[model samples]
Target: STGGGLADYIPFIIFGAVALIMTAVIIEVQQAVRKIPIQSAQRTVGLRQVQSRASFLPLRVNHAGVIPIIFAISVMFLPTIVANYFNAAPVDTWYYKAAHWIQGNFAPDTTNLPMAITYNVLYFVFTFAFTYFYTAITFEVHDVADNLKRYSSFIPGIRPGRPTEDYLAAVMNRVTFAGACFLGFITVILPIATAKISGIPHNQMYLGGTAILIVVGVALDTMKQLQTQLVMRQYRGFIT
Candidate 1:
C-alpha cells in the first residue's frame, strides 16, 4: 500500500481554503466601484425647458485588472531569459558570471533569502507601478472631465473645468493606490504561499492568482455583457 491518507491531503486542503478566501477577496474588490454623483444643468429646449437630472459616473476599483499582472511577469522574466542565453559562455568569463548572477538573483523561482527577497520586492514594486501606469493610460481623467463638462454635467460640488479635472485626478490617485497594492499582492502572493505552505517551489506552481483573476474577471465581464444584451433586447421588444 502507498499509505496515502489525510496527512498527504493537508497541503491540498490548506491551499483550497486559501484559494476560496482569496476568491472572495478578489470578487469583492473586482466588483467594487466608486460612484461619483453628478448633476446635469437644466437647459432650454426649442419650445420648452428641460429639468436637470442627477446621475453618477461609476469608476471601477480594480481598474487595471490583469494587465498589471501580465506586465509585471513579463518584466520579471525578461532578465532571466536574457541571462539564460549566456549559458554557453565560459564560466571564468566576467560576462558569464554577470549572467549567472542575474539569473540567480532575479529568477522568480529563487529560494535563497536575499535573492527571493529581491525578486518579490521588485516584482511587487513593478506590479504596483504598472497598475497605476496602465490605469492612467486607459482612463484619462481629463477626457472624462471634459466629457462631463461638455454634457452640462458637474460632479455635484466640483467645478466644471480644470477644477473638475483636478478632483477626478485626486480621486483616481487614491483609488489607484488601493488597487495597486491589491494587484501587487495578488501577483506575488501565490509564489510566497507556495514557498511557505505547499513545499512546492514557486516555479512549479503553475496555477497562481493571476489565472484565477483572469478566469473570474472574464466570467464576470461575460455575464455583465450578456445581461446588458438581454436588457437591450427587452427594451427593443418593448419599443416595438
Candidate 2:
C-alpha cells in the first residue's frame, strides 16, 4: 500500500517540476522585446539646429499572452457543453448516441488513446488559430503607423506611411506565428509527455500544459505591471 501510494504521487511531482521550468521559460520570453530603431526629423530650436532625436519602438513577441489560450479553451469546450444537454435522451435515439460520441471522443481520457489524441489535436488547432486572431485584433498596424507618423518618427530604412504599416504587419505576422506554434506545442505535448514518462493516467495529471501556460503568463504580466508602476513612481519623485 505504501509503494502504491508513493507511485500515485510521482506524476504530480513531475508536473510540479515541469510547471516551474515552464514558468521560468515564460518569464524569460515575456521579458524579451524586439527594438525598432527610429529617428525623429530634425527641427530648428531658435538659433541653434537641434539634432534628430533617436528612440526605439519595442514590440513583444507574445503580445496577446494568455488571452488567446482563454479564448481557445472556451471555444473548444462548447461542443462538449452542448452535448451535455442531450444526455437525458433515450439510449436508442440519435441525440443519445451523439452525446455519447462527443463525450467519448472529444473529452480528455487517459485510458482512451484515441480520445486523448483527438483532444490534443483540437487543442492545438484552437490555440494556434486564436493566437493569430487575438494578436490581429489587439495590435493594429494602421494605428501603430499613424502614431509613428504623428510623432515624426521613422524606421531606419522604412518609409513613413503605408510602407511602414506593411512592414510592421509583416513582422507581426512572423512573430505571432512563432508564438502560436510554441503555444500549440506546449498545449499538446506536455500532458502526453508527462503521462507517458510517469505512467500516470491522463485524468490524474491535472497540471496540463495549458494550465501551466496561463499561470506563468499571468504571473509574468503581473510582475511587469508592478515594475512599470515602480518606475513611474521613481520618475514622479525625480520630477518633484
Give the best candidate by lDDT. 1
Per-residue CA lDDT of candidate 1, range 129-218, in tens?
999999999999999999998888998878899999999989888989999988888888665875578665567666678877998899
Instruction: Write model 2 residue lDDT over 1-240, tens digit each, in one string.
Output: 999999888867777787788777777666667677888988777999878889988778777787777887798789889999999999999888988888767866635778777777888899899989998998999999999898778998999999999999988888888788878777777667777777777678777777777777777778889999999999999999
List the lowest-lDDT window of 10 residues for candidate 2: 103-112
- State residue 68's C-alpha deviation in candidate 1, in Å: 1.1
Q: Quote the positional error of residue 106 for candidate 2 in Å.
A: 1.3
Candidate 1: regions farther than 4 A off = 1-4, 198-200
Measured with C-alpha atoms, the lDDT of residue 235 in candidate 1 is 100
Model 1 alpha-carbon miss at residue 214, Å:
0.7
* Alpha-carbon runs more than 4 Å astray in model 2: 1-12, 44-50, 110-112
Global lDDT of each candidate:
0.86, 0.81
